[model samples]
Target chain A: MPPKSTKSNQSTGVTSPSGYLLTCDPPMKQFIINLNDKKSADKKFILEDLDATHLLIKGDVRDEITRKVDEWMDENVFSTIERVGENLDTS
Target chain B: MHQNWEQKISSYFSCSQVQNVLVMPAPSKRKRAGDASSTASKVGRSSADSSASSAANTATQAASELTKIDPQEELLSTSKSLFEYLERLPPGTLRSIYNLPPPGGATVAAAVLRSSSLTDIARQCALRLVACGGKFKVGSIVEKWIQRHGQRDALLALRRLESMGILEPLGLANRPGQGNDDIDDEANDSEKRAKLMAKIACLTPEFKGAMKLHLSTMSSSPWPTIAREQIEEFKKSGGGAKSDGGEKESRDPPAPYELELYTQSSWDSVLHFLVGSDEAGKDKGGVEEPPEVMIQFLTRIGLMQEDPDYNGADRSRAPLVITSKGYEFMLRDTNAQVWQFVLQYLNSLAHHNMKDAIRMEALSFLICLGSCRVGEGYFNSVLQSKSARILMKDLARFGLLFVCRVAGKKAFYPTRVAVNLVASNEKEGSRQTDAIGQSVAATRSLEESLSAPVPSRSHLAVVVQTNFQVVAYTTSKLHISTLALFCDVESYRRLPNVIFFHITRDSIRSAFRLGVKADQILRFLHVHAHPMLRNGDHQLVPSNVTDQILLWDRERRRVVMDEVWAHQCRDSSEFAAVGQYASDLDALAWGNAHTNKLYVHFGKSEMVYAYIRKWRTKHYNS
Candidate 1:
């Protein structure tokens, strides 16, 4: 699961930061395609680069491509955050 | 009404996840915003934009020179704005909003409003998403919401998205709602503002997680001044192996890697990460490459040669894949070694903007920096706030710090090599004298370490004083030749890592010409000189000698090349290719552009040699 935020604030015309959104990775594009396949059940959507891999979302069961892909792309392309963290409290 | 709306807005969007989602503006609109922001890099925007009624276009020339140099001033001011959004973003919705659809669809307005305005009616929308996670048409999602409720409700819903890290974060001293908004009089100190600005100066990028992932995947390094902590860990772990830097991770109990040679695949990953980024496909979705690759690489070709039970590899057992020793070494201080390589690699690629491929490396880099003991008094909360994961990863991937594993976590140990990556590392520079004194003391200790030796025994000062008619210290041949390069040699021989030489006018001139100005060289000598010269007259190296050296260097030209790897191609790019990928064993070579540095590390010695010698008859001298 993605790490949850603590406090929330008021509205401003803020937009998602592009640098954070499209971090520019080859696997990100493919990860989205693989994420959308509902029937594949491979749930394993992998983003690989260098000698490291950031995440592997299990999306093998879905066959329809777009939503699954969008969902995976939502988390993977924009971040490489893993489960382990500092100052993180998981109760 | 505006205040009430703002309050209602805050209340509606108080959920962190909703705040996170609202942070992202609609995708199409942001693309335009990105372009407007890019111009900020070129032009100097006034700092008054926060309260200003309209955007000012104040970029001119001539007397506006200082303004031009202060180019990123706008970026600086906006840093606060961005940070708040990320901080305020409601948890789950933050990432969702950032992932807005790429245009086109029914319910576009609803999806826009619902997702964007999540904070205001987040539960309602989340209920909608739970109601229609897969079936809702995005554009229609917005239209449907407005149709159900009225435009007032829709506008409020839309306003919800505004709370997420959407609008570029302005440089507010604190998160919008975190600080006291009523600081009207007493606390209005410029000093406090300066502290706030300093805290801001040290603030990590709002998208620190992405930045780390970006650097890690892209294989970039941190700036030179900020040494990757991983490297420091390596040094501590290597030399201080007897003692723990702090704590060691328990993931893999310390074990020795028993390998004879590195398999081509594992070796490449290690080298590539070190050289900059790990290879494509090999990183395995790791922050970069797994530590296993480092052990495998080192075991295969390094210090393991001394292992008594080493049987290279059982070509018959597993073929020459990876030896056990290789695995152990990598696990030993793998994070640090990787950091050292990345820092050097990033230093090499300093000229390029981060590419996506090496982000994992950068992430690993930052993890190593942040890995250091946390909540310790080493860096205050303010400095931590400023850099955190963002600068750390970027700096580490580029090999700014020597990173190592500590307390089951990655830790950073900085090195002095990368010069500009320093993020106020010393903590308090408020007292200039203290800062200078700290530096001087550090230098003194460093010089002493070099002189406190065994065997061949030669001090750099003795070597410099040779031409000044003094018997010098030092037995290292490498040092002798290096000294001879600029100082006149009274005596020396290039036998190996040892030698002896006297500093002379010609060499002094050369040294001065090569950037070791007379004063600096003299200072170096004074600091490291035989303890006897501490109180001696100013005739340390002799002003006459220094003058003559400066005179000699007058006509000499010192060339510096800023070299970097331009592109990577299969070494066999010369071969005709219909459609064949080079097998893992194929020898890979790189194309390089050495900008102004005069030396290149030799393939065989792994030592930097004058490029002129390596290039032979190449196109031209740098």
Candidate 2:
């Protein structure tokens, strides 16, 4: 089972859309993740699997998680633009 | 080449700094914030938008740098953080969390985290995979969290993770009874996945059951519920062919026996080259020897001393002799042998004060390759920089990596030697010998037709006789050269696969002069003893030979050698003062009170002379 949303609330008050918590108060150190998927959940769906991953970060999870999400999004945009540029050159 | 005694003595104590060397910048200065993101971008962002709050920038900067260097450094620091996290919890919660076994996923998990160039994605992927028990379908991960937006990046991320040992390709053998564990020869990918669907999973090296246990017990938010029925389905139908549950899981395919022979010969030639032995001139059968760059590296590290009479104008005629250090190095285990050179190279960089970040990048890259699957292709990624490419090329020359270049593209593969170099071999006592034994076992199982002529196993071919005679059962040029270190080869026989040699007092003494200790000789003999003579539990060589070798060693060490000068004083009182001064300077070799004479060693004689000359002047002036 994914870490209980209740457990995350009790530990770090930072809340996300699907009960994911990223707190930076105690410094996110290490978290154990379960890579196996739930059978009842839509195995073919997208974004739902993010809730399947448990995150343990150092300090307050709020700040670190926000920064991480923002950085990841930026990477996606940057790579997409670079791919476009490569396509233009190839064509 | 005699020198003046005064000048020689002074020179021995002098300290001089060589000024012509390049110094590298500090690591922190090179760790620029947003460098990872910025490197990928062509159009620059405005300064106002680029300049984030200093704290946030530094945190990201630190994270980026940590990923570049040792990926395990983050795991180590985070584990420490977890320990602290556990300490702050209430007693009841703490007790429950503590009761759960520690997650045994550090090394493999750390490698997965290092797989991605972007820190955030790597972290998320690693966390989820570990929670799911280190096994996930590649398709599941790609479709669920990483599609549509950054699909290419996500795919590349998975490939990188697979190459770095995080996700293993579950071939026919990984399942319960499909593959015969007795055979180690690698099957082609097509042959492995011919009828079955491609299955990939995160696995800890040498430990899968423990990882599963830890994941099952983990109950926390964000850990998805694992379907027991689905897992049972995978476990039952995963393997292609079902048989009697007797086949052992083969972790990795062993390289062909010829590769082992090639690696050994190349390394041994370098050592043989130092001992000034004719074994270096032996047959190569067309395979190339290790490059001259390795010889130069040994010379640079003070392991091999260059010939003083050699001329640089005749570059091809350069000759080098093994120094005392090199002789000692010969007896070290193979891992240690490689490390001695790598450590020396790293130290040379440090000696020049090369930038810590650059040094760390090179060091961590090499270490990371240890876990990478052999024969896998890694396209341009983190190792795209010119320096990184050059370093990889240099390592390839040493036979640590086999670089395959095809039509302007290069894919590097780690050889058995490279994998062995970085294997965290934890078992102590005779493990190197066991490594040799395992190599032989692999060779035996690989080819039976070519077994008689080539000595199937490198480790199983040596036999030690009670009469101080050694017989090595192999045709490997490397084995022959290593045996020549302290033995006289009597004959090379083909039928029974044996090369005979006799150990003598003179040979052992000569080797000792070159700094090969008695213990090292014994260890070599023990580790390389024939599989027949080396009964798993007993001593390898005869006790008489070991005892005689030690006795010969003890005989030589009984005498002391030193350079000293005897000085006569005007009186016993003056002699006492002079002797006291010599003793204080640590130069007094011997003192005779009756004769008013004192002896001083050559190195500290200058200090002794200055002190006595001043004393005499003071006595006369008074």
Candidate 3:
């Protein structure tokens, strides 16, 4: 079993700051997705359908998606700091 | 008159106009052309030749005297001295100077300055050169502009210039002679040209103000400036930077840490899929349909293999497994990992005959995404470009971006992977590596990450005990799956959060079969070993277990499994002929002359088979 994220880490409510993780399993929102291509017309996809591995998030998930990307950037910076520290130690 | 000429020369060759001077060939080359005109004068009738020769002799003496003047000192003291000397030459001599290789420096400088894609570091390096002193060593320029940028990055930038033919390393002249006159002459000419180029690069001031202005524009405003009114409208509509709680904050939005974390998982899942330990059923209840486009892309790159049993028509039923290529890819750092995958993707597209422009647009889009800020909606604006939109859709398949389409309106957000690529391109430099430059400031963190190798331990939550027992503190399925490669998971505990595993000889051999090296496994353990176990030195894991694991892995080397296709011929002569053909292709793996049989590597067997079939048909027909 994977270790459980703490209550704070477990994004529970959509409105909660910590709960706003894109990876968090949020409630399914009914949204109409119109494929930008010529082939597909307006169709329905749940928020879950826009999972990260095969993401197709459309409408209203803008804040959620932005929040997710921001988190990724922060992690990148954090890892960078860690790497720099390790290099310093080794040198 | 000499003093007045010197002042005119000095004023013209001021530091501010150094760019023009640098781009322009040295006064020495211009003097040589003047020498050419003097030769032309000497080529007339006897009396005329005699007078012309004497006149030319005096001119030669004057030119020689000018040459004796220390060029560096003259240029440094009075910028106009060199230009003044050039001015003294007849207009006919100017053509030869013009005929010389058009100043390579100014064009490169202009390109560097005007380039929207040039990284801040590269731009700064260019700016510094344009503002450099007339007399300076190559080492000094490198020290002043490049060293602090990062040693690897500096080398990459220099290499980039060398590849572009804008700068040539001084060492090329020192290489042993090719012994061919033409080659030697070319080398000599290039050496002279490079020296002149270096001088020009050192003193150029032509683009200094322009570069400074460009840098200031980059610093003051980025892409947002292009669509400034749109941004104002966005802010007016309360769609600007969001606060931590998804509210419109009075302050700028906090960095989107969660999105980055999501990006990490998204990328990790793709990696997990490659290694066969994806946390599918255990976490997500059931394995969702594998991302088909992503799988197809990986298959095309030969990183993942589709099930042999599945036909091309059945998309969902095609089971995919990680190839040996994928196994090696898992061990690389994220930048290298992403690079190899993207490179392979591009190569595969090229192989399939995709137009160069489309491939280039795909590449530029990736770099642009990397340069853009994490939370910005700039990705959507870039999608307005058709080729970029197509590329973004493919990028979403790679988990580099998440596309949102609502009622035919599409917006895309670049993931951390996409952003990392921007840093990768700039840090790596050179077209061979792929060049992608963004505004300098936006890429500072990305640059640091790209230039420095990230420690794998930072993500590890494992501990290897002296007794060969392994305990991991995290729930990341990826970690557990990786551990399962060389350790037997003895138990999974809940309360304090730990998974216990025992390293065994069999498990070690199993990992070796999967193309995992002894050192790789040891490094993994060493990186994951608990803080308490790390103790003074770098040897975190116990020496006994590490050595035993390596020995176990090595033991598998005794018998090699070579996959080959055996072919038998009717006669020894035929067998020998076919075998020779196979050997020529380097496909012949083994042969038994006694049995008139030969074996070829599976990968090359088809070609050998075709040749054999053709020879057999021709012989029988004849």
Model 1 chain B scores worst on lDDT over the 10 consecutive residues at B255-264
Residue B178 shift from truth in candidate 3, angstroms: 14
Expressed as tens digits, the lDDT of each residue in B39-67 for candidate 1 is 22211111111212212122111113222
**Could you tell which candidate, 2 or 3, scores higher by lDDT?**
2
Top candidate (TM-score): 3
TM-score of chain B of 3: 0.47
Instruction: Report the Cα lDDT for residue B316, model 1.
Output: 19
The residue-level lDDT of candidate 2 at B527 comes to 57
The alpha-carbon lDDT assigned to residue B208 of candidate 2 equals 40
- Cα error, residue B213 of model 1, in Å, equals 22
lDDT (10s digit) by residue, model 2, range A8-79: 442332222222222221121122112112223543112212122222222223444345443543354321
lDDT of 2 at A88: 22
Model 1 ranges off by over 4 Å: A1-91, B1-344, B347-410, B416-467, B470-472, B490-500, B506-541, B555-622
Q: Encode model 3's per-residue lDDT on B524-567: one tens digit a residue.
A: 55544554443455456778877778766654432222345656
Q: After superposition, how far is residue A45 of candidate 2 from its true place, in Å?
A: 98
DockQ for candidate 2, C-alpha atoms: 0.00
